[model samples]
Every structure is written in structure tokens, then in C-alpha cells.
Target: MTSQDRKDGIPAGGAGGEGARVPVTDGLRFAFGTLTVLPVRVTRWDRAAARAGMLCAPAAGLVVGLASAALGGLLLLAGATPLLAAVATVAVPAVLTRGLHLDGLADTADGLGSGRPAEEALRIMKRSDIGPFGVITLLLTLLAQVAAVSGLYGESWARGAVAVAVAAVAARLALTLTCRTGVPPARPDGLGAAVAGTVPVRSAVLAAVLVTALCAAAGGLFGISGSVRHTLAVLAALGAAQLLLRHCVRRFGGVTGDVFGALAETAATVALVVLSLG
Candidate 1:
């Protein structure tokens, strides 16, 4: 390991930087290239660059949420059923991200449900095919998301759109927490290793606070009924993300690329569900 690797627990062998510096343009490029199917040219692949990219991930989510809200709102305006509108909204990010997060969620569920040693479970996760556990988890999670968002849209389009945006932003914010310092990568190479332990605890906390405040502010902007309840729903989603983080830490011994995806999907789903119920 290089000195930088030892210092940050990140894999080495990329463009050298005496100290990590993330230009806004490079960060945006990396975030878009990694998180979405958008055609963004990424010129950097080093540890420092990857860390910078992860820090800007939420910006990608903001774009995704805006698109999702637009689609749902359009569908509603066309007199589509609430269920159909919800499905469209849910599918928007899936398509934009190439269902990467869902794949992560499935792999994670399959791995953790295997009841095997960590090494064996990791092997299971690395496989290309999905398993029964993954199938069941994906089915249930998708159903819950569809049902909840559908109900919310059935009530009001503005409220549903705002919730979608908030959930997307919150989901990406969860990544900052997941990558905080001391979190080990699942492997010595790959996406997880490049980003693991990159985020400082201070940065993670600040991101969390900022995301919460933004989501809460969204409730009022959208004229959601029971604005307090909407804010609480965002908190609930964050709480769920925290629980998943703890579970991954315990089950896998640390965070992985799949874990990050799983957290994003789970947090987004929980946020939508809570908002729908409210």
C-alpha cells in the first residue's frame, strides 16, 4: 500500500495527489458518470477523485428527483391512475441509474440472508445472478414503494412530487454517512475501496443536517398537509438508513459498493412510504 492508501485506507494506483483536491467540475462529472446513465465524461479515476465524486453524489440525486417529479406530475395531469403515476416516478431513477441501486439491494439481501461466513456471503454477492432471497426482497420492497407513492399521488400531485425529490436527495445523503472514516471496504479494489473511509465524520454529520433541513423546507414549499409529519417522515427515512448501515457493518464487517446501493434504495423507499402514510 502507498502512504496515501495507509492513511485513508483507499486503494492506490491512480493519478497522484499530495493531498486530495476535488474541483467542482470534476466532482460533477464523476458523480454523474458513476451514479446515472447520463453521458458525462469522467477524466479522473484516482482515490482522491473518487472521494470527491462521492461527496457530490447528492447533486446527481437532485437531478433524478426533479425528473421523477416531473414525470409523475405529467402522468397525473394526463389523468393517469395514481398507481400508474407512482410506478412511473419509481421507475424514473431506476432507468436513469440503470437499476444499479436495485441490483445492489438485491445482492445485499441475498448475501446477508445466506447465513454463511462473511467470505462466503461476499462470494455470493459477487455472482452475476440473483437468488431467491434477492427476488423476494426486491418484490416486497418494490411493492411497498409503489403502494405508498401511489397513495400519495392519489391525494395530491404537488405533495407527491416534493416527496419524491426529498427521498432522492436523502438517499444519496445516506452515502456520506456510510463512507465515513474507519469504515472498511469489502475488497482491496473496486468502487467501494476507492471511497471507503473517505468521508470525515464531520462532513457526514453536516451532510445529514443539511439534507434534513432541505427536506423539511420542501414540505412547506409544496404546501403539504401536516408539514410536521412530512419532516418526521424524512427523519424516519434517515433512521432506516442508519439501521441498514449498522446491519451492513455487523454482517459484512464494513461497507461495500452493494451496501451503498442498498442503503440508497432502502432509504428512498422508506421516505416515500412514510410520506404516503402521512
Candidate 2:
């Protein structure tokens, strides 16, 4: 290991470094530091830390979700219209992540819509300027998210809050799955390469199960039907994300940070849509 790696508490030889166990706190820092605009400082950069951070991603999502829900709920309690509450709910995640995922979604849309070779498409994605495809995708995605959240809020404040939280957690769960072993990075460097295939498949699966169960429990605040609805929402969201991941992998030769962002936004949107349905 380099002196820098040692200073960062990373094990030698990258992820294969045996006998190195990262503390939960370091993992949490990694997750929050990279995934959101939170003030946490990440002290590690090795694959071991990445694996642990991905495993803890859902927990970070939970915190973001709760913060989003809180703002929306407070607005409702203050007699704000459901539309406004829904807008706040949709905006909170974007604000927290510094719009990183939305930007990714746009870039990925541009890349996919270019109809060019993988190399050219990736080049398109790297451009700072948003293309027509990216603009349209962003417009449609934000509209759908706001509309779905509004519909849920119309039903009841509690339902809206629960749905928001569940969607956030589901979004991060998708990220965890995307990093599972066998998934390759599209590029030789960048955030995607650092985290790609770092997580064990079994660990990813366990994280998904736990996140889904917790979502179900949150929905159980209403009734058995509520629990079932939330459970299905999580499953459906993950399925949608998985399809996107597969398509991106084929089109780009593997995943990138932009692809990860696209996957997250897709999952969150799908989860909210599913929850809004009867």
C-alpha cells in the first residue's frame, strides 16, 4: 500500500487485502461523503472501504429520506397545499446530493440517445453542456416525480411521508446492487471505477432484503395492505433499475458514475410511482 493509502486506513493491495476490517464509522463517512452533500469527511479510499460504504448506503438514504419527509410533513402541518409539499419532497433529495444524480441521468440520456458507438457516446456524456436528450429527460423525470408525490400527498400526509422515505431508501439500495461483484466499470478511472464490483453479491442481496423489510415495516403504520404496497414498490423499483443497469452495461460496455446516477433516479422515480398507485 502507498503511504497515502496507509494514512487513509486502507488495507494494502486494494480490495484483496485480507484481515483488514473497516470500522462502521469509516464506512458511514464514506457513504455520506460521496453520496450526499453532507459534511462528513471520508478518510478511506480502498476497495475494502468502498465495499463497506456501499453496504451502508441504504442507511445514508434513510437519513436523506427522513430529512425530506420532515420538510414536507412540516409544510403540510403548516397548511401548505399538497402540491407544494410534493414539490419539496421531490426537491430535497436533489438538493442534498447537489443534483449529482439528476445530472447523471441527463448525461446518460444524452449518451444513450446519441445513437453513436460506445466510445463516442461516452464522449458525449463527458461534455459539460447538456444536450437536447438530457434536457427532455430531466424535464420529464422531475415532472413525474413531483406528480407522483403530489398524488400521494393528496391521499394523506403520513402516506406521503412514508412513500418519500421508502423511495429514498430504495434508490440507495439500487446503488448497492449496481456495485455488486461481476459488474464492471466503463472507464479505467473515476468514482465508478473506484466502487465498481467492490461489493460481494451476497452482501448486496442482504442489504436489499433488509431495506425492503424496513420499508414494509414503515408502511405497516397503515395496515397489511400498506405493507404489501410498500414491499411491491421496492421490488418494482429495483427491477426497473436492474433493467436500466443491464441496458447501460451493454451500451457502454460497463457502468460509470453517470450510469450509477441514472440508476438511482430511475429507482426513486419508480418507487414513488408504485407507491402512488392503488
Candidate 3:
């Protein structure tokens, strides 16, 4: 059989952009495609799965939207209050990312709260336990988010879902923004260099646009806006995301995965709460 014929459906060679023969496996599936964490027993596949992996960063929002709707449906079925949906809209992300942002939040809080230099703040961020400042900061952020999301749930579900979707995509856009404009990898290579730096600006923009558009579609489909509140909500969340990311890039250099996670969660929460008001 020819080289192409000898291969299964998987691309035979020239997978990762060169003439090299990339491995094929489920791990490669996740890494290469929108499927996060590999399909199964496959992470080392040196092949490309753009149509899938490329979507992973943005698809996160779609997953979140469905997750929120699913959880909300479940709670509603159980005869619980819509307020319980707030848990799905808000808490699931923490569970999804395993509270990575809390780490960033702690790191940010500990860093800024310490009144130390930027380098020292980053160093403290690498610490394990939360300081008093971190503790207070986490509490306040959580309170603000919970209060906002819960309040929104009482009035509208569509806005809450849209918030989740928009915030999710915008957070990645912020990461892309930070990734493109910043110092190089702090170490030889970590997550930043491996993925962030390599992501082309247009690719990042496309991914971001795709996510943001999904949100706008949701809002438009549901007619979820009235008065000037909708515009303000979008502006506020996107604004918060931009300001925070810029601050971090200026202070800490490039963005970390922790920072990205925090950005998405915080922005989504803020949008939901703010927009729901009017």
C-alpha cells in the first residue's frame, strides 16, 4: 500500500507541520483537538488536531453554557429554587478548573497586598498557603460573585447563561492579549511558551471572536436586554478583564494559566451580576 494507504484514517506523515510522522493516539486527540485532556491513553501524539484542539480554548465556554443549563435544569426538576441555579452558573467553573483562579486570586492578593515589588509578589504567589490578605481578598471576591450571580438568577436565566458564555471567551481573549504582548517565558519553557507565545494573533482573535459571538447570539436569541444595562454589563466585564490582565502582564510579565482561569471566572461573574440589574 502507499504511505497514505498504509495509514489508517489518521494522517500518515507531515502532521505537525513538517515532513515528520506524528504519532496517533487518544492523548494526541485531546492535545491536538478541542477534546481537552486527551481521549484516552494518548497525550504524546506529536500530531496536529487543530479543528479539535484549536477549539478547546473557546469550546470551554460552550461546555460551560451547557453545564450551566444542565445543572439549572436539574435543580429546577428537583423543585429547588432558581437561586440554586446560581451554584451551577457560578460554582461549576471553580470545580471545572479546580479553583485555579483562587490560586491566582490568592497570588494576586498576596502579591499586591504585601506591598512588595512585582517580583516578590509573584514569588509569594508561588507559596502554598493563603496569607491574611489573601484570605480576606478571596472572601471578598467570592462574596461579590456569589451575591451578583444569585441576584441575577432571581430575575433572568438567559442573561446568566449569556454571562457565562461571554465571560468564558473574553477571559481567553485577555490571555491572548497578555500572551502576545509581554516578556518571554520566565523559565526555559512552561505552559506559556508551549502554547501562549505560539498562538498566532489572528488565531487567538478568531477563537475569541467565536466565543464572544456565541454569547451575543444567545442574548439576541433570547432578547435578554432592556435599558442601557446590557451594554454596561458587557463593557464592565470586558473592561475588568482587560484592566486586570494588563496589570498582571506589566507586573508579572506574561500571563499564567492561573491568571487566565481567574480572568474568565471573574469576568463571567461580573457580567452576569451587572447585566441582570437592568
Candidate 4:
């Protein structure tokens, strides 16, 4: 398979392009194509396109969040158990995204758990086989997501749906933060290198702040739990991302495609857990 078919797929930017602005439409196409299983036509392959995609990553998350909420809402309306509804909500996004993030999460766990040099750890991550660490991490993280969402649904369907959407958006926002300037790629090539340092710190900060505010507002509107709880959920997700950032940098030397996926899953899971508490 070509490099584009890899876990992180192709990097947003390619060689031999600079100083020209990419259109919003191009960015949308790239974000949707790269981040989701949705069929989108992405013709541009340059630094500009990659930058646009990072900026538009939240848009893709918004779409995924809505779908997750809809699935959970349908299950709840159909008289399914809260646990069942939460499971479906959690499972649907994984299916929709083709389990890309989950794969990343597993690979990251295996890599970090290996306790080897950065080079060896990265090689382990590139292997297609799942290790014991990957399996255990997947089980625990997925269980946490299901349990948290189920608890939130037990409180109120509306609250659960809001939590799902907010978590999805927050997860994608983590990607932008990870790609911010000064962040190094784990390898010299591939998805991590292509997009690493592509996001400016200012842009990342602005996007993160806006996404947080939007999620908080959305949670207040749909959160039967409490506006404060919703705000806390967003903060919790951000905190999760921060922790992941520190850990990945210290452990792997920098971010990789797997790191991005790992961050998203971690943030989403923690956000849901926090929201469930409300």
C-alpha cells in the first residue's frame, strides 16, 4: 500500500509549495477526507492545505459528534438501556471513523508501555500487530467511555447527547494543539512530520478557546445536568490533552500520528467521564 493508506494516512502538506493561501473549501475537503471516512475530494496537497485542514479539524469533529449524539438519542428513544445507548454512541463513532483513532490509541499504548528507546518504540507502533499493552489499554479506555456515557444517559438523554457532541469536538481540538508550532514529529517523514509544527501556537490557542466556549454554551443549552458541569467537562478534556502532550513528549520525544489519535481518544473519554458526573 502507498503511504496514504497508512494509519495516519498521508500528511496534509507535500514538498514544493509555499507562500500561497489555500481556500476554505480545500481545507474542508482535506479535513473531511483525512479525519473521517466521509467521501470527500481533496485535490490540494501542500502545506497550505495541511494548515487549513488542521484549522478545520474541529468541523469534522462537529460532524462526528452530531452523528454520535443522534445514534444515542435514537437508542434511548427506542427504550434501550442507558448502557446500551451509550455503547452504541461510543461504537458508532469508532465505526464511522474506521477505528483510526482507536488504532492510534492502541499503538501508542504499546509503544509507551514497551519502555524502550524512542526508535524502537516507534518501530513497535508501526507494526500491524497489537501487543498486550494495546489490548489492555483499549479495553480500559473503551469501558470507561461506555460507562461514563451510560451514567450520563441515566441522568437525562439530552445531557448524554450534549456530552457526546462536546466530547467529539474536544477530541479533534486536541489534534490542533498537538500540531502547534515547536512540536516535533516522532519521525522525519510520514503523517507526523508532514503536519508537525504546521499549526501556529496563536491559531491553536484561539481555536481551542473558541471550541471550549462553544462546547460550554452547547452544554448549557442541552445539558440537563448543569451549565457548570458542562464547562467542567470541556476543561477536563483540555486537561486530558495537556497530560497526554507532556507524556508523549517525554516518552516518545515528540508527537506522531498515533499520538494524535491517542490524544483524541483520551480527551473524549475523560470529557465524557466528567460530564457523566454531573
Candidate 5:
């Protein structure tokens, strides 16, 4: 839809047959998209309006993160194997974010994984097919996550699930931060654009901090004690993720959906590893 139409409160999903079809504002679209994907309606898309859609980014991240955990749980329960579990998580998202992370992975791969100049690598990323760099990046990240979870599950399955859940939450929280916190646009459109359309940085910062607090508490499960220490670890993880993301964004000239995915995945993996070691 046109930006003007979006501004005019044209519903992304237009009028319905049965009842009053309140025009879905671009403001609320991501939140609506998020809620619609969940198993429960505990939080409705309409609720996001109060927060000016900043919550939507984190909320959407939460859903995907949780979905990853649940999917991971099912895989572990069924003895489905770690690699298989990873595959399931990717496959399960019916509305698959149009290869959101895959695109980032590809672009980043083109830029970093490939030995070519940055401009040429980025051009290669824009291609639909995968390159050797893209393939390797995807494989390595997937393997890293699967291996990390498998190792955690070996130690404590509950902790592993918690790791997955918290990571999911954290990753999503990352999105809110990126969208709201003065993230310059990388592309004119795509995930970054939509995020720009929604969350404001101030609200994102608060929400991200709150999420970090919760995650730090989750960190305690790794044998780290005291809420204060745990919170510090969580903040540390987030701080590290921020520094890492900043570098990646600067390197790429902007973060894409894949970088968003990669950042979340990397942070989650790091958190779980640190917890396990703790």
C-alpha cells in the first residue's frame, strides 16, 4: 500500500464481511501481524496502538522466538535431532518472513563471506539464488545454533528451552531497539522500512531494557545467582549484541532482516553458552 494510504489508515487487510472492519493503521499492522500468528490472543494487535507500535517489534520478535523454543522442544521430545529441529523451526513459519534472515545471511555473506569488494558482494546478495558465501554462512550459523542447543540440552533440557525462549524474546527485543533507536535505514524498504514505520527509539529503548531484565533473570538458570548479577550478565549480553550489531550495520551500511535474524541468533547462542559455562 502507498505510504499516503497507510497514513490514511487504510487497513493492510481491507474490509471484512461480518463486522466493522476498522481500518488497520500502518501503526498497528506489525502488531496485528504478530498477534495473528500466535496460538493465543492474549495480546491483540489493537493493544499496540497505545504504545505507538514500538511494542509490536519486540512482540513480533517474542512470538518468533517462542515459536523457535516450542519447535525446539518438540524436536528434542521427539528425538528429532538438533539439525532436524532447526529445519522445523524454519519450515514451520507458514508466512515465512520471505526469507528474512536468509536475505541478510546472503547479503552479509556476499559482503563478508565473499572475498570480493563490498559493493560487488552486496550486488551478488540482491540476486535470488544462493552463492557459496551465502550457503556457507547459513550452514555455519545453523550448525552453531543447533550444536549450542544440543550441548545445552545435554546439560539441562529445561534450561535449553529457557535459553530458546529467552533468546527468542531477546532477539525480538533487538528489533524494537533497532527500529526505535535511531537506526538509519539500510534499504528503502523491506523489514527495516516497516520497522521504521512503526517503533519510536525512546519507547524501544525502554522496552528493550525491560526485556533485558527479564532475560537476565532467565540467565540465573545457568547457575548464576542473585538477580543483580544475573541482570548484569543479561545487560552485558545485550551490550555486546549492540556493539556487534553496530559494527555489522556499519559494515553493511545498514542492517537487513537477516542481520536482525543473525544478531538475535548470535545473541541467543551466546547467552545460552555463557549460562551453560556458568
Candidate 6:
């Protein structure tokens, strides 16, 4: 695979040149091709395509979230314990994305914890092996996810499933905001450069609003309190992701693929934790 392919699992392609009109299907292809290990082909690599892909990211997350919920629900129907169902819920996203986001999370953690200058820290993150920081962060993150999910499962199957779905969509929504205009790329080449600052600020905000509203509607199945909780969870997740994005920009000079991964995981964790609360 070329560097472009390595950026986000998008196969290197030359379709959709600059000034080419990007169709919605191309956008969907771009989103799934890069964000997940799905079999979609990415025929476009231009800024417009990237913008569309980022906007459609939440839709891709919805599919992933539903898949996660379905597996957990099935396991429960099979007489499995809540803990086992939670594990499956947490594992499905990682498996679907081929652990791309998780790997990025580890790399970002190692880079941030290196205590070195920006350039050196970026080099550290690029190394193949995981450092102590990466190992510890991954351990804590996964454990927290499983624990929170298990708690929700213990409450009720619907609660657990909804939480997983909400968390997944919120995670990708964070990515959309991260790529909004004004965020620069950390490197001249890579996924960051390809997608950084691609989205218009208004478009990104609109996507967030729409997603939050949909999530709130989904939560309405429970009650008024459920709607409020889901709305707050999304807001809190976005706030957390924004904070991380700002810090990473300051520390690394701008956004990177690893930073994107870190933001997604942070948002997901925060959303799940919030949903699991009373």
C-alpha cells in the first residue's frame, strides 16, 4: 500500500480530481473506505470528497453502533451474562475498523506522554512498537469502556444497546468537528493533511446538531429524562473532544491521524460514561 492507503486504509486512487463534482455515494464510499475495514472502494481523494466523507462519518458510526448493539443483544438472548455482552459491544467497533482508531489512540498517547519536543514526539508515535504510555492508556481506556458498557447492560438490554449506539455516533461526530475549518494539519503528508480543515464550520455545526437531535429522539423511547441525558452526553462528548483537539494542536502543531483517533475514543468514552450515569 502507498502512503495514501496507509493514511486511513483508503486505497490510493486518482478519481475525483480537483474541481470534480463529488456524488453522495462517493462520500459514503470515502467514509467507509477510510474509517472502517468495509469493502467499499474509494474512488476519490480530493478535498471535496474528504469534506463529504467527514460529514457522513456519523452515518458510518451508526452502522457500527447498531452492529455492536445487535451482537450484544444476541449474546444476551443466548443466556450470556451482561459482562460478556458488554465485552462484545466494546469489541465490535475495534474489530470492524480493524482496530485502526485504537491503534491511533495508543500512538497519540505515546506521543503526548513522551515529554519530548513536537518533532521528537511525532517520531516516537511513528515507531512500530507501543511504549509504556501507550500500553497503560490502552489498558485503562478499554477497561473503562467495558466497565461502563457492562453497567449499562446490567440495567437493561435496551439501555446498553442505546448507549453503545449513541457512543459510536458521538465518536464519529467528534471527528467531523475536528476537521472543521481552522484546524491545521500536523504534517504535510498523511490523512491529516488530506482532511484537515476540509469541512466548513457551518456544515460541521449542522451535522452535530442533526446528530444530537437524532440521538435525543432515539433516547425518547425511554422518557423525557432519557432525551435530556442523551443530549447532554453528546454535548459533553463534543466538549471533551474539543479540549483534546486543542491540546493536541498545541503539542503537535496541528492535527494528525493519531489525533483523530484519540479524539474519537475520548468522545466515545465520555459519551458512554455520561449515559451510564443516573
The numbered model that scores best in TM-score is 6
**Model 1: how far is 138 from its true place, Å?**
0.3
lDDT of each: 0.81, 0.88, 0.53, 0.84, 0.54, 0.89
Task: Indicate whether candidate 1 or candidate 2 has the larger TM-score.
Answer: 2
User: Could you tell which candidate, 1 or 5, scores higher by lDDT?
Assistant: 1
Clashing pairs in 5: 61-172, 65-168, 180-200, 180-201
Q: TM per model?
A: 0.91, 0.93, 0.73, 0.93, 0.69, 0.95
Error of 3 at 72 (Å): 2.4
List per-candidate RMSD values in Å.
Answer: 4.6, 4.1, 7.9, 2.2, 6.9, 1.9
Worst 10 residues of 1 by lDDT: 1-10
In order of listing, the candidates' clash counts read 0, 0, 6, 0, 4, 0
- For model 3, name the residue pairs that clash: 27-42, 27-43, 33-52, 33-53, 34-52, 34-53
Could you say which candidate leads in lDDT? 6
Report the C-alpha lDDT of model 2 over 20-92, residue by residue, as the tens digit: 5888997898788778888787777788888889889988899999999899999999999999999998899
Model 3 worst lDDT window (10 residues): 1-10
Question: Which residue runs of candidate 2 sit more than 4 Å off their true CA positions?
Answer: 1-19
Q: What TM-score does candidate 5 reach?
A: 0.69
Question: Model 4 over residues 14-112: C-alpha lDDT tens digits?
Answer: 543544677789888878877888878777777777778888988999899889989989888999999999899999879877888999999999999
By the TM-score metric, which is better: model 2 or model 5?
2
lDDT of 4: 0.84
Number of the candidate with higher TM-score, 4 or 5? 4
Q: Residue 39 lDDT in model 3?
A: 26
Pairs that collide in candidate 6 are: none
Candidate 6 residue 218 C-alpha distance from true site, Å: 0.7
Q: Which regions of candidate 6 deviate over 4 angstroms?
A: 1-4, 8-21
Q: Candidate 1: global Cα-lDDT? A: 0.81
